[model samples]
Each structure stands twice: as structure tokens, then as C-alpha cells.
Target: MRQVDRHPGKAEIPAGELWLVVDSGVKKWACLSCPGGCGVQISLSLNPEHRPRWKVEQDFWRRPTISPSIHQQKMCRCHFWIRKGQIEWCKI
Candidate 1:
């Protein structure tokens, strides 16, 4: 995952790279393309006040691990976990 001052454009984020939107030194959003190969854009909230907020942690290698699995309820309906910058798809 990479930190960006603002939200990145759709094409700006390369495969397997997540953009962590940090404005004023505060993490605000986590954006990435759907790992389900559905060509969907996923933006998860990092705000504590918001429902379904996700927390991000980084290892010494700068690999990111997000708490709670990402579950897409729309088109793809893909469910997965990101641990150590790797995608672990749920068996459903």
C-alpha cells in the first residue's frame, strides 16, 4: 500500500497496490481495485466515527494488514482479506 495526499485516479493505482489517502497526516481512506477481477473500485473508510470503518497496520516490510475482511456487496460480491499485502479470498 502507498500513502497519497489525495484520492488517486482510477488508472493511477496499479495492480496489487492500495492507495491510503492521508490528508493532513490522518488516514482517511483506503482505495484499491477489486481483487475479484470484477473491475470495480473499492474505497474503504478509515474514520472511527463511521460504521464499517477499517483499521490499517503496517509491518516492518511496509506490508499492510487491514482489520476485518473486505466484503463487496454490490456487483462482484467478493469477500477477502488482505494480510501482509496479500489477498486471501474467502471460500464462498
Candidate 2:
């Protein structure tokens, strides 16, 4: 997904777009839609001091790679990984 440097809105973002919220030059959050097609918004914390935080790396092409995996406890409950701007679904 394309990483955008901005705050996440209360509404749903466009497909294939991820928001990287930066506050005062510090990366704070990563927001995106559920790749499972559930249309749920997922916000990940980027702060190192947070309990549940994910590391976001972008290649020179602007493709995003998120460390570990994303598991939605509610809604679709889809677990997946974002690597090189592609979604890799985890086996159930």
C-alpha cells in the first residue's frame, strides 16, 4: 500500500492507501483498510514505547513493509502481512 504522511480521518480512506501519521517529525500511526475486503479500518501504532506497535519500512519505490503481522480480533478477523506493497494473508 502507498504510505501517506498524514493523520487518519474518521472516514474510510481510498483503497491501496495507507496513512502514516507524523507528529512533530515523529512517526505515530499507520492507518489502512483491511485487505480482507471487509472494509474495516486498521490503525497501527508506530511509537517504540507502545505495547503493540508495528515497524513500517518503505522501499525507495514507496512500497510499505510492516513487521510482524496484523491480526484483527474483531470484524473479519483477518491476519495478514504487508510486504513490498502486497498483502500476504496468514494461514488460518
Lowest-scoring 10 consecutive residues by lDDT in candidate 1? 7-16
* Candidate 2 off by > 4 Å: 1-6
Per-residue lDDT for 1-92 in model 2, tens only? 54456766777877788888887778888898887788888999999999799999999998899987999777999999999989999998
- The regions of model 1 sitting more than 4 angstroms off are 9-12
Sliding window of 10 residues with minimal summed lDDT for model 2:
1-10
lDDT per residue (tens digit) for residues 1-92 in model 1: 78889877665466788999999999999998888877788889999999989999999999999878999877789999999999999899
List CA RMSD, all candidates: 1.3, 1.7
Candidate 1 TM-score versus the reference: 0.91
Question: TM-score of each candidate?
Answer: 0.91, 0.89
| Highest TM-score scorer | 1
TM-score of model 2 vs. true structure:
0.89
Model 1: pairs clashing at backbone N, Cα or C within 3 Å: none
